[model samples]
Target: MPAGSSTGSLLQTLFALILVLAVLGALAWFLKRYGPKVGGGNANVRVVGSLNLGGRERIVVVEVGNEWIVVGASPGRINALATMPRQDAQHGDHGGTNAALAPHSPAAHSFADWLKQTIDKRK
Candidate 1:
């Protein structure tokens, strides 16, 4: 092949590579800004609420059960500030320490009130 033809071909290939990279980068950005919207499916996950950005609102979902519980507002309305780890759920967890769902249930805010009781009990 002629030297000029080879050089032209090389430049064309370079241009094609650059274009492909740019397109890939844009796609990654779009997904990074909007990927978790579709990631919430587990029943243990909790949803606080949703938010509308531009014209689309993403459903927010949090995972909480078994060993971990996430607390976050749905639809990307809130960012996580603090998270607390709790005991792993026993087979009878709902009727154990925090039995809010039982017929002979304990107080609703038993867990929340524990903190207050802790300090008082210490005194």
Candidate 2:
């Protein structure tokens, strides 16, 4: 093999590698700037709270429109447990706590405690 040919081949390989890396970097930047949102872009539906019941079971509170729906989710099944009016967000009652479902006091037990008590009564 000619020395000149080997150097040309090495340069070609490096150029290909650099091109691939540049393409990958551009794709990552585009995705970071324009990818789908974490939860979703829908304004009508939002997850207000969630409590893990077991390894695969959880109770989720979802706010839809003017009401909040309690849902029980486990593996392949999801069931709506209850529905109630949406809580007021103006009083800092957003993101994972509902005053109607649990007491509203700094000294009070956490929402998980209230949920556990409610579940114990059903058994």
Candidate 3:
């Protein structure tokens, strides 16, 4: 093949690949933003909060109707860890001040603190 024809073929291939990637990226973003609400936002089931446990595992707190459920999620499986009534505010305080009152630490309580306190209370 002539040098010019080879260069033209290479350019065409690169343009086609770039177009496919752009289309795929747009589709992915669209799906991630709008996919979960397929059942409609009126379903009354929503994720209140989530904590990553590394890799694909995490703990997700979901509000289903008037109930709050703590779920352990990994890959294809999900397990309920705890269930409680949907409180006006998480951590029992209606004022939304569930943070540790330590002067040295930040006012906002980390998920670890909340998890530890919840576990200690159980014991």
Candidate 4:
């Protein structure tokens, strides 16, 4: 191939690679932002609440089907801490949505307190 033709082909290949990378980056961003909502109303599983215990440790409450589950999540693994029937929030049930699912005080629904109760029950 002529020198000029080879250079032209190289530029075209570089442009194609750059375009592909840009498209991929945009796709990743789109997924990160809106992917979770894709299931929106139809999805049975939803993140009802989350609490960060430390740098990489957290307790997350998720509602799946008609049940609510407490999950212990870390950088490495996720474990189910507890599960219970879904509480109705709109009808004045104290278990509000989102972060409200967990009370700030050392209340009955707090993770530690709940865990203690559960352990005591098993005895």
Candidate 5:
């Protein structure tokens, strides 16, 4: 057995294992901390009502009053939108002031969208 090759292979395998574990750990933590709530159970978000913004534009009523919002899952995509008439108003989000709010990575998509995009890009 070649000592150098065996040592290098062992190190590579260990690195790969560590990477996988780290990814899984992060995902689990995210799910536990920020996963949306459902029914009467605990969740990061709560659905209080439902409204059809338009045909096939059904939005689950989430936040309202201060800043009416319609959050829902569409085509496996989780979306949170402000349901106010004046979109550029001051009290939009109603969560808090975010003068620095901007689109992050063009708004993350669902796993299905990611998969579709990856395949489309390859073609």
Candidate 6:
């Protein structure tokens, strides 16, 4: 093989590698800028709260429509533990203060605490 031919082949290989990387970078940028949203921007379903139970288990409170759904999630399974009517913002207030905003209020308990109490009540 001629010396000039070998140099030309090396340059061609480098150029091809650079071109492939440029295309991949552009594709990534396009996807990140105009990709579909994770939840599809749904307004009806919202996560009210969540509590970690163990290494891969969690209790999640999801607000769907006009109700709150308590769910237990672990790896591949999600179970509906309970359901309750959604508490409106107006009903969350006591006197002139919101119970959730009051640190010392009984209703200010964390989601985990509330779930514990609810489970205890059922027994």
lDDT of 6: 0.72
Worst ten in a row by lDDT for model 4 = 96-105
Per-residue lDDT of model 1, residues 74-94, tens digit only: 455754522334333446554
Which residue runs of candidate 2 sit more than 4 Å off their true CA positions?
A: 1-7, 34-39, 87-123
Off by over 4 Å in 4: 1-42, 90-112
The sequence of per-residue lDDT tens digits that candidate 4 reaches over residues 43-76 is: 7888876778899999887889978898999988
Worst 10 residues of 5 by lDDT: 94-103
The parts of candidate 3 lying over 4 Å away from their true place are: 1-38, 90-111, 117-123
Off by over 4 Å in 1: 40-43, 46-123
The model with the greatest lDDT is: 2
Better of 2 and 4 by lDDT: 2
Residue pairs in collision within model 1: 45-62, 49-74, 60-74, 60-75, 64-69
Instruction: Write down the lDDT of every candidate, Cα atoms only.
Output: 0.48, 0.75, 0.72, 0.73, 0.52, 0.72
Better of 4 and 6 by lDDT: 4
Residue-level lDDT tens digits of model 5 in 1-123: 699999999999999999999999999999878997656654444444464556666656453433435465566676764343212224554322222222332322332343344346568
Positional deviation of residue 107's Cα in model 6 after best superposition, in angstroms:
12
Between candidates 1 and 4, name the one with more favorable lDDT: 4
- The CA root-mean-square deviation of candidate 6, after full C-alpha superposition on the true structure, stands at 6.4
- Model 6 lDDT at residue 11: 100
What's the lDDT for residue 61 in model 2? 82
Clashing pairs in 4: none
Per-residue lDDT of candidate 6, residues 1-123 (tens digit): 699999999999999999999999999899888986676589999887677889999988788997778899999999999776665555564211221322333473445565665687689
Worst lDDT 10-window in candidate 1: 99-108
Query: Candidate 6, TM-score vs. the true structure?
Result: 0.63
